[model samples]
Target: MTKDFTPPVRLDIDHLQSLYRSGGLTPRQLLDRLDDYQAAFTDRNLWIHYLTPDEREPFLQTLEGESPDSLPLYGVPFAIKDNIHLRGIPTTVANRHVRIVPDASAFVVEQLLAAGAIPVGKTNLDQFATGLNGTRSDFGPCGNAFDPDWISGGSSAGSAVAVALGMVSFALGTDTAGSGRVPAALNHIVGLKPTLGRLSVEGVVPACQTLDCVSIFARTAAQADRVLTLADRRNPTDAWQEHQQPPKRLMGQSFRFGVPAADQLGLVEYPEAQALFDATVAHLEALGGTAVDIDLTPFSEAAALLYDGPWVSERQLAINDLVNTPDQVHPVVRDVLSAGDQFTAGDAFSARYRLAALKRRTDAVLATLDTILTPTCPAPYTIADMMADPVALNARLGAFTNFMNLLDYSAVSVPAGFLDNGMPWGVTLFGPAWSDSTLNGLAGRLHHRVTDTVGATSDPLPDEQPPQPLRTLQVAVCGAHLAGYPLNHQLTDRGAVLVKRTRTAPRYRFYALAGGPPYRPGLIRTEDRGAAIEVEVWRMPEDRFGSFVAGIPHPLGIGQLELEDGTWCTGFICEPCGMDGATDISDTGGWRRYMASMATTETRQ
Candidate 1:
């Protein structure tokens, strides 16, 4: 070996990507260094199965022709929670009694691999993903990355540790409630939970199918953002998959953020977490977020529904035959799932109804704010403390998290500050559905403001880079290309942003295009028969405009259209021949409104 061939110890996506491009590192070299890193942290209990050279060769083979610039995750190594399948790997869900070797990767894992990411192993979890504390596993606990005596928050424990320990650039964990966030908080890493169904959960062993979200843990928010981008690609096979596009509402220069009213924060017993949260509020304000105190009663009630209410029955549905033999499960985990058998179908409906009411109330309150900030975990506990009273410790860890999936929101947990004892503390930025990117940007800007270290490592924080706006043309859109709509991601993924919203001039006709999966609309200029319609103007990169135009298929074409204010620009236009037998939708005035009416009409039919 060359004497000065230093390894790329900073395993961030951007850093490693740069090293790869500069010829400073190679995939083989990275694997060798990871071996040294794992050897140093010998007792962390972070893996259910770390891949051997033979096991990883197939993955490396897939990356032969990939380029990092094209596939941003090319050559990057990642780990998955045991509950999620990776083809040819055994998914045990942290239990030896239950082993399932899958022939297919989960939808998200397949997407990651296709984008050039390599899987190194599967990480340990709470048995069946049932506990927030890591100790319920037969493989033993995954201790805190900072302090071995402290608990490594679970049920995604080892996934977080693998990232914090620099074993991988990122790791995947399933978050039903707080499993994703708590572990990141304890490990001083970024935990990102997208909106429900945002990432396809197909092939993931669900704890609660309706609430499960495939989450990501990374050394920085930027890295997590990249993984989220890749994992959130459109999935056609997963029934739960939703086309969750980014929100368009801009926070502007000054944004409104909420916090639990003085007495509403549930951290009275954990003074350190409480202090850190208070400081976090101030930090948000410094970042141009106006902090407001709001009542957390409705949110707290919704959180209780996850475990205290009949939603426990969903756990019973997840593990088919495993529940038949409760002895095979951990005692506390079995105790929790046993309650599922006691709930009647009527109980499930009642709990759901109550949750709906709370969601309505939460929405009404949150309409006045951009996001709500809170401690990622209200209290940090030792492994002994969690084991002494399993159920209660888990609840405390989930205090600020369980309500998120229930309420259909998105969140990012980032390192806030360290506790006096040198353990890391963190806070979560949360908002309504489709706001994953918003919370991501805010969490990162806040992390840069508050911390200077990554995980338990002595390495310094990477240099912060300001976001650079793309050079784009201000193209007007009136249909599917609008933000949060079905096809909006095409614009967003290409660096487009919705800049202006307005109505078109009364010289165009709207028609519902024939044929569907992704239904679309077409507009045409007519001499006399026309109506002014709603439209959204987006700024798209000139370089991307050609590719965007190329994907317009046949019926729709790019052409000039007049806006309400007497301006003309290229927009959606339909070929007259393709309009045969198409339904006229000018009455609805816009594509979104037209689609809403079609849905309502279908429901009635």
Candidate 2:
């Protein structure tokens, strides 16, 4: 049977629809394919609760009883994270003692069933979705589908693995931080964490009730977007769910993407990962995303709040009973949950206060640009490496994720490429809350444009070369005009496409102006005192650049800024007078890069 079953890996939703429509494969055939998937994954630890053939046969038979018009998913098989309820399938959450109800499908699960998608099983996850590495699951860490020795990222481990292994057309997972995203990065799949509260959270166990989100895993961002559309129906039971439409295109030009400085601790040791990330960032600009540098401090601080502060208690609050009962909980999960006991209500309140402040700071920074792109995982670790240092490894994995939920943002992790050693590197696109639709559309385009393959499938998608409108001026901004920074909106609101990041010639000086809610940096041209400043260039519609130029204040005027290698374009510059009282932040180079350095120093202090 294993020899005969060659189920197409990464069977997208449309392909399934075509097969079911042509009578080439029935609901029963898909079920048999799922069985084959189960057999193929002999040691991958991909599933936590698989529906028995008896349980799934009836659903398949019922589909046979109906015509194509009745089924949206038709015979497409999918998997769900055990944290979500599934009728007749135990929602173990990778734990042994959790009570399992026999017939409570999560609202989304019911919606999928109504659309004719068959549930094949429940996948594994970090215990209560606490860790980022898949290793924390009681069912055994979900090993990477692409490479057995590597860690399949988690807390959404099994769902990613299931899809990567051709076990299902798509799967459901939860993202709190990078659970939904990191695993997809490791397994080379698409992970979509919808806008907070966009998808109904009713019937699913909470990791952090205030910030927990139901995420989707699929072969393509397009498929994930479709699933989100189907599951986005109004639910009176979930107050967080809201009706919204997917954005057709992002407005503005010169999208400024925030990238971590090379010196950032997370990337300092992982040079190869850093190189891969740098290349990805360059790719974004090459694809027309303006790259900017920002301080990583506030983000790192927010991440620390998740585990070091009181948010762990929130998870305890969700599954308090199972956590408090000793024998019922997995030992590892017990240790993680027990840490929450140290927190008091005051701690929770304090953490909330600090997080709010940090979020404001984050938002102020993000307001300057359209999107923030970062490595889905700073570095990849193998199961053995993770087992040797579980806590540290886990913490490192969440470096880019823990702040997401805390800040009320949405993110999608898409495959970028493999490291030199063959492990994968993925990039994540993050936007503020309610921007899921926008980010979804952006990620869909990015995936099709930059990535050659979808999910774990070997099939390559044709390159979608983006349109470059002629008669536009590409202006680079090293400071405020960079998106998500305080001044970036000025460019975006005027229409800009972030084109690239190129260093200015060694004749430029960087200054931090004194007494500036949004800090402003002054770039001055000096013969002996200047060094190349790291700045991002954004292309404004030539029609809009003139108006943008008109808004510039004195001292900080627009000029042709020369790059390190003699490339020159219009950008923000300061007169000698502006530097009188300004701090010579030239040593740090550009504004965002300087901010990144400051953030790191502050965290250590």
RMSD of each: 11.9, 14.5
Candidate 2 lDDT over 390-481, as tens digits, reads 88878888888888888878788887777777667788998876666556656766776556665555655533323333335668787777
**Residue 17 lDDT, candidate 2, scale 0-100:** 74
Model 2, 210: alpha-carbon shift in Å?
A: 1.4
Each prediction's Cα lDDT score?
Answer: 0.82, 0.77
Model 1 earns a TM-score of 0.77
Which ten residues in a row are the worst by lDDT in model 2?
1-10
Best by TM-score: 1
Q: Please, what are the lDDT tens digits per residue for candidate 1 over residues 1-605?
A: 00111224778778888988888887778887887767666567888888889899988887776667888788898999999998888888888888788989999999999888889889989988888878889888888777778888999999998887767889999999889999999888999998888899998998888889899998788778778878877778789998755463334345899888757776765677677888888888888889888898999999999998887888877766554576778888888877888789899899989998999999988888888888887777888988899998788888889999999988889998877777778889888887776677777788888877677765567864422122236677777787778888887777566656788999988888888857888888887889998888876556777888888888888888899899997788889987887888898889888878879999999
